[model samples]
Target: MRVPHDDGPPPPPRPPKGRKRPGERAAEAGASDMSQEPGRAALSPTVAGGEAGESLSLRPQSLAEYVGQAALKRKLEVFVRAARGRDEPLDHTLLHGPPGLGKTTMAHILAHELGVRLHLTSGPAIEHKGVLAGHLTALGPRDVLFIDEIHRLAPTVEESLYSAMEDGRIDLPVGEGTRARTIGFELAPFTLIGATTRTALLSGPLRDRFQIIEAIEFYGDDELAAIVCRTASILGVPVSGAAALEIGRRSRGTPRIANRLIRRVRDFAQVRGARSIELADATAALLELGIDSEGLDMLDRRLLTMIVENFRGGPVGVEALGASLGEPRDTLESVVEPFLLQRGFLLRTSRGRVATMKAARHLGLELPPGWQGALDL
Candidate 1:
């Protein structure tokens, strides 16, 4: 179906013509307007910093092209259609979940489906009120402003958005001292799309402002395998279904990692002079990368090992674990622990993190007898 144009009513009068727009000035100032970050692990489900360009190209442009999140996709399709039909901007939306589940991509797809421009920024990127104002004022009618890691926005900056999101205007302080005065400016109607991994960090008021809230779940292996194949196709590398599935199985249920792994596997296949990727190529590549059959990587194993060996099959707190492992608590909670918990290798109890019996078996370690009974496992 043809998407309706976003040109509903003319936008409110914009700043005088010749004066550079806030968006333009912000762009020139190098505001954190980028969609993805840099320097993250290839296996991380979050956008890999090093492969931003490739990731952008691999991203599905429309909801139909997106894989996984069946329920979310259905909801978004209806929402997008309804919004477009009404010639109105979509309601403010908040997407929260673990990273790498395509929250950013979904934002892009929303803009694409709505036939509107997308303005990208992050919570931390809006360091102050001025930066937030610049981004807010830059939006055109029906445009999408996607703020990734929205939970990280400073209290002041986040509060500044309340009025803009609710009433389509902002009151900013101008001048200094006795000359200081508040100026309220009317803003063009637009949609705000906020994504966050730590939803709990968001203020209640802020969370309540979003008209639509959806949680992104991890992809199923089948969905991830399809993503693998799609990425391989986009990279012009031939991949067998079996190979794609194998990569997907080891992808920790994340498309970013699946895409990243396929690229590495392709490298192995190319070096071996193979015309296409096969199961063996994927297996060997993953083995060389130290990702086990269960998708546990070095860091995962390290965390498990620490719990098993040092903490005696831990009921250890995350803080203690982080201190011992020399890793950040946030990294442990967000990245390493989720997959382990999902795969039954770890458990979180009132006491702390506990390595499960399955984890002990995987590590080939013999836990003390009666330990399972004590832990009530």
Candidate 2:
């Protein structure tokens, strides 16, 4: 099965020609960027309209706003200061870790700290080497190229980046069919900020080219609580510390998840005419949405079920498991499957996906009766 394209989901509805959609008003959560392209607009992160939601200006406006990543934050501060002091672009940096842990946040933050212009693009958007070369040649000195999901880059496009990164040059092909002249275009010194959730899948040659690689880990419950409360304050949602903590604990350690839950709770609060979101209100809201207390969503549980029942306490191929669930195989492969595999909750075997013994017992299902002879129950 092929990796999914950014075409992972359907595009959000565009405004009716020139008319705005209902429920989007000034100061509303969805009104983050009124001037954004009509096809995709998200007030909060997560893909709202096929494209990754959240705009450049919508990224946290300042480092104080970036929150968490204390150690990385300190190191990056020094790095940015040194580069800015010398008036040079920052080193080509890589941000890696689970999704929504602020990899993109750091990319934007770095650009903001350097006080330089930032140009945004992504790995998948550059389908061919020429298209990428076009963007590279356009970069100005001290500019930042922010590429999200860097691991998804096409191999040729990835190769093209090497010369540009190493020597501030983009080699372009002038003609086709073997008589092509290669022209080296000089690019102004620029910073390449790459963000990826699947760093392990990145090739050694690609990974080795980065000067600084920082992995963003899951925020602690307290950090998430602070993020939820801070975000609510920004959106003008009246939330208490308890309310904030409740939402944060169930957020699966992702700020994107915390911000999303806050929006949902705000809607509930407004509909019920409640004063604000409380612990109980937040719990009831999340339960209604099928996000369990432990942050397991419907798909999370379904993954366990498929491994336990269909795979028969043994390994099974990913494509077959994806087919069983009727999920887009690419979505399963890229977004959903990684977290499960990382938590030791699921095992990837040479044959396929296997349910860890811990996973089987957590779901309260009986182990296969016949498997007792082959392995301990």
Give TM per candidate: 0.85, 0.78
Among the numbered candidates, top lDDT falls to 1
| lDDT of candidate 2 over 164-260, digit per residue (tens) | 8998888878898888898888899999999987877798998999999988887777888998887776665668899898888878778888888
For candidate 1, the 10 contiguous residues with the lowest summed lDDT are 39-48
Model 2 collision count: 2
Give the per-residue lDDT digits (tens) of candidate 1, residues 186-304. Answer: 88999999999999899999999999999999889999999999998777777899999999999998888998899888777766667778898889999999999999999999998
Q: Rate the local accuracy (lDDT) of all candidates.
A: 0.88, 0.78
In candidate 1, which residue pairs get closer than 3 Å at backbone N, Cα or C atoms, i.e. clash?
A: 38-49
The local lDDT score (0 to 100) that residue 70 gets in candidate 1 is 91
Q: Which portions of model 2 show Cα errors greater than 4 Å?
A: 1-58, 176-179, 312-315, 341-344, 348-362, 368-377
